[model samples]
Target: MPAPTSDLASFAIALAEELPGSWTTEHHTHAQYPDQFDRAQHVWDMNLVAHAIAEHVLGQDAALTRDDGTRLYVVARPRHGEEFLIGAIAPSGIPAEAFRTVREPDGIAVPDDPVQAAADITVDLLPRYDKALAQVHDNAARLATTPAPELVVITLTGRDFHVSKPERADAVQVLLANGCVFDKDQGAFVLPGGDTAAQSEAIQNTAAQLSRLGVGLTVQPSRTTPALDTAPATAPPRTTAPAARTR
Candidate 1:
């Protein structure tokens, strides 16, 4: 029912498809950076990503929130397989263990080798995660250059849906078995740890919880907060930060 904070990949996909006007880009800041691989550069890059998502995906003064009181916000980067930090938002703000979490403390029964057990734990799932990571990469590419004004991060924030990608779907199944929270909205597994059913249940429970949080189902007004700097008139509106650009 609340907005998704951990669902950055969705935002990235949306940004790639939406956003408007020409925008600039830069790097992120890092901690130990006297050179190109410096942390400062990383931080700078992340900021640019945040800007891109804010301007391109969400559009002007647009954002979404669900009912369970889960809040979603726009940011520059959502954690993915380290390709481009091209700005995004996630709906975390679902903790790692928000859904069903399984602990491997007793240790999974498998060959004594740690590598084998770990591999066995996800022998069928590695490919899925890899593919999902790849999709995220593709999404990053699209968001960087998309030129649309009405950006909307499309995602199914509920249960009973399936990832179209085979590998990703497999990984979701595996991760669910491993106690990871595979958020349908976020796509990335909430490995605190996530898996398939957790992912499914997150959406279902979220919808159910959000139902009663509404003010008689009349639609709440936007919470104009987060912006703080002078920006382009067309820039996404922000309360304490810039709002993602949308219609």
Candidate 2:
């Protein structure tokens, strides 16, 4: 089996990156029949099988329809194990499927041909894929509303301050609107000058807004805060008490 062309591979990578979850290249070892000499071919065959299942059983269109209206395309990403993340760009949004555990016939002779194998696998797996996609959508929605931990970290860097882990998109936007410029090379948001008071106010406002949106913020301790390091004064030793006890 031939590997996916460079163009197809690039498109898949871009699509996967655009989506919310982490995705990796689809490798032959990740295929159901890893021992097969033509692993890429097997994957391609499986993709075709999945597309057919989507059309016939799931009532979905091909991942990609060519301008010529002759050929269709499907791209897939491999997870750590048997799961394959498959999708195609659509007019409205991405139509995707996740195949983790595929159903197979009981004691029926599985065909050696890749196309037939894909068909068999698809028949069992398509339903599972639909269910998984639904669950993924639900989880994503829940995560959006659920309060995240203090993922953003703010650190004082020389005369400026840098913000790290700005996980929330809205929080980043707030920071940017309030004069925080993202340093692409450093992968952080930088606030210029040593105006501690002004910086503090900005940080507070950003935190408050993000908190309202269920996003968390963590501010690094400022070195200028001597008060934080100062311990309460200990009482002087009772020298007079010692003399009185001796007398």
Candidate 3:
């Protein structure tokens, strides 16, 4: 016979109350493959693991799905004779899943005291939860700072052009090889200046070269020296530009 509905409902009620969330329950039955003995055996073994020690005591296993779609399985026969074990059956693909326990040895045990277990789990996981959240924020910050190939600034100083640093090492070397000097005072790579027509041509050629190599350049008069034109670097262009001539 299936486990008493009252017993399942009672356990779910206790956990839901402790967690204080909208939760719904479902009867979980192990899938059987009558035509395939090996498959059936494998599923049975997996179910045994999923149900934990509660298989024999509960006579049936069940799951609780939160309003947010996170599922926690019921372990009726918790080790140490605890009343029930509420834990994830699989990774829920959510932040909570990172610290939420399972039925494994390393997983947190849900004792008879559902309220206390909930509190303890919160306390135990707070640091890790905060850390996980922090890591996500840190990654976003890194992405925000990533170089924008399209915003490569080329400022026309009195004589030469002051170019902002490109993130690529190869791009840096290319600039250095083409008679560019790193000016510490200006914090930009200085390109030699010449006749107006020749300088314009050279700048355009260099810009095109950089563009081919997945970099961009924006030429502006030196009056805008203090700020480098910048934008969030998106994925490089898919189509190739014609081979750029060395300046």
Q: Estimate each model's TM-score.
A: 0.20, 0.30, 0.32
* TM-score for predicted model 3 compared with the true structure: 0.32
- The top-ranked prediction according to lDDT is 3
lDDT of 1 by residue, 1-247 (tens): 2222333344333432232322222223322111211111111111233223322322212122223321122233322322223211222222111111111011122222223323443443223333433444454455447532211111221112222211333333543553444566855444231244454344333333323332010000112311233223444333232222210
lDDT tens readout by residue for model 3, 19-48: 646777765443321111111111111122
Please give the lDDT score at residue 242 for candidate 1: 26
**Per-model tally of clashing residue pairs:** 68, 0, 1
Prediction 1 TM-score vs. true: 0.20
Q: Which candidate wins on TM-score?
A: 3
Candidate 3's displacement at residue 25, Å, is 2.4
Q: How accurate is candidate 1 locally (lDDT)?
A: 0.27
Off by over 4 Å in 3: 1-6, 29-58, 91-106, 125-247
